[model samples]
Target: MDFSEKPVLTGDRTVLRPFTAEDADTMWEIVNDPEVVRFTFEPSTELTLDGLRSWYGVRTADPDRLDLAVTDRATGELVGEVVLYEWDPAARGCTFRTLVGPRGRGRGLGSEATRLIVGHAFERVGLHRVQLEVYADNARARRVYEKAGFMVEGVRREAALRGGAWVDGVLMAVLDHEWEARARTDATQVTGEPRLYTP
Candidate 1:
């Protein structure tokens, strides 16, 4: 969805909505977290509040991507974010990524948030495929993606460098029809946390 009309997606545990300037503070804390940095970005990456503010400030106005803040519905607090970017219009595909901070981990909020946004991507955004890459060592993140219906397609050997060691990046994707099939099954079964997260 575009900035002007982005939808607020709600699930049993989390809510996904367009990012706000106020979210930058929490996001800064989340992004700088040791676990977050190790898994999602490089340790050498430097971030600043002003830069975060400036970046998030304009996210809603951007026409090409969908970036949403993931919030815990119980406390109405910002937990993390989920994004769909690198869109290929002709292919009807896009890349997905998500991160959960220390405050929101271990409660299955990330999984629920992923299901919500990926659902919106296929049903509302008219995307045919949603894909992502996760480091093989990040089992928690990969489990969340798998529970949300993404299947591992292959691995990119030594796709990322972490702590001076190369890490494999696992590629995963879910197609529209696969999501629809999962939806039908989900409707028939009682849905709950597949397992506790250690995030």
Candidate 2:
């Protein structure tokens, strides 16, 4: 599985494309959203625009990880990001994570983005497994992951402290065979097939 070639994945509701320097401001706003920060990042963490610009500017140059911007298909607005990092070449697996800002919440954009990138990981990149850790209290995100074919494997007890309370981190993963089976089933059921890296 190679992360060197970042592709644009197209789904029904969203598009996943490699990040550019221009995306830094929008990403900063999304990451700073209270709801987004509460679930995905430390509440007290501070991020500067210059830092974000510098970071995003080189996303495509990083060969070890894939970081794609999640954009609304209809309006072409940046919503969030879907990332696959901490690559294990021998295991052919990586960690997945995503965050949607308020503008894209409750619209199934995040779910579609998740499916698109995960599909690319297994189908095009030849990855064996995709795993993620979701805070147990975030049932909504868990549901999204489940819908995308990730299954709960275990839990890290008290993995994070949020708002003065310890939150458990639920581990989830989807294997390549499992994803392929689900894709074949979806195709038989007439569900939308994911399209990636369209020319």
Candidate 3:
């Protein structure tokens, strides 16, 4: 998980690349969306361009985190960002996070982008597993993770407090083997291709 090396991943509708200080304004706009930040622990606030730029500088310098900017290929519009955090070489695993703007929601961009990231992690980075914790209330996000082949491994009752009430947090994970099997199944459905990777 070398953060210094940026990987360019192109999906059907979007492209993911390393985030730069120049992208601060775009990132600010996306993260400031109340709906986008509702389920996450981070606070949503309006950031001055300078403040965002400074933050990006520090984040991009981190050596163990992979933070990518999601962009629409056709329009070259900055839509959102996805992050893989807590890279551990010994464990060969990481945690995932994502945020997509209002205009980018419901188009399946999040799911597609997630699939691409997971593929890159297991195939390119040689990670054994990728995991995420999402609020049980975020059904849409949970569905996206499930579609991408993550299984719910555990649940923490009343783990998050949102909207003045306790909410459950679901822990999900997909191993390298599980992802390979899923890719094989998808390839078979799309082109009658034989399985290439097995769990």
Candidate 4:
């Protein structure tokens, strides 16, 4: 989707910008990290620079997908990434996913980055809903999503085989109304302005 033309989103510690071929190396590093890919769906072989570049080509060509490179705003260092996947134009909803490198872990970057992306998805992209499927054992990620106001809607028992054992998957979602209400509460607390949730 012409992501280069999309507005970059800024947060307290990070910036979300369009992903480019130049980011291949950074992505390769993270995607190959065993700890980083443990609970995720990344391929085991580890992506080579050439493979990443080719993947980037296909990703950038898809109009419905939005892939962003997460960077530390203060140092301009690549920290992680966020993606909005399986977008449904008619339904105006999509699945959200995120990953952080080792250096970016344990710093609340995941939660903060998610908040920023959720805001963009609802307020800027005009999406009706955002959803995600997280590994049941990934408590940290589940907490991040919960703190961002996504409700646990369902669970798939033994949905994936990880670490030589079956694991459940939890489905979470936040609707536009929920996001709007949260935004209103935030605005009222910060600016003393009354806001309403319209959608």
User: Which candidate ranks first by lDDT, i.e. highest?
Assistant: 2
- Candidate 4: where are CA atoms >4 Å away? 1-5, 42-46, 190-199
| Candidate 4 per-residue C-alpha lDDT over 83-190 given as tens digits, one digit per residue, 9 for 90 to 100 | 888888888899999988987888777787898888888877888999999999988899999989999999999988887888999999999899888878876887
Model 4 per-residue lDDT at 177: 93
lDDT by residue (1-199, candidate 2, tens digit) is 5799999888888989999999999999898888888899876677899999999999999888999999999999999999999989999999999999999999999989999889888888889999999999998899999999999999999988899999999999999999988877777566455532221
lDDT of 4: 0.81
Note the Cα lDDT for every prediction shown: 0.87, 0.90, 0.83, 0.81
Model 1 scores worst on lDDT over the 10 consecutive residues at 190-199
lDDT of 3 at 65: 83
- Candidate 2 vs candidate 3: the lDDT winner is 2
lDDT of 3 by residue, 96-180 (tens): 9887888788988888889888888898888998999999999989998999999999999998668788889999999999988
Distance (Å) between predicted and true CA of 163, model 2?
A: 0.2
TM-score of each: 0.92, 0.93, 0.91, 0.88
Highest TM-score, which number? 2
Better of 2 and 4 by lDDT: 2
Stretches of model 3 off by over 4 angstroms after superposition: 43-49, 195-199
What ranges in model 1 sit over 4 Å off?
A: 1-4, 191-199
Show how many residue pairs clash in every candidate, following the order shown.
0, 0, 0, 0
Candidate that beats the other on TM-score, 1 or 4, i.e. the better one: 1
lDDT computed for candidate 1: 0.87
Residue 52, model 4, lDDT: 89
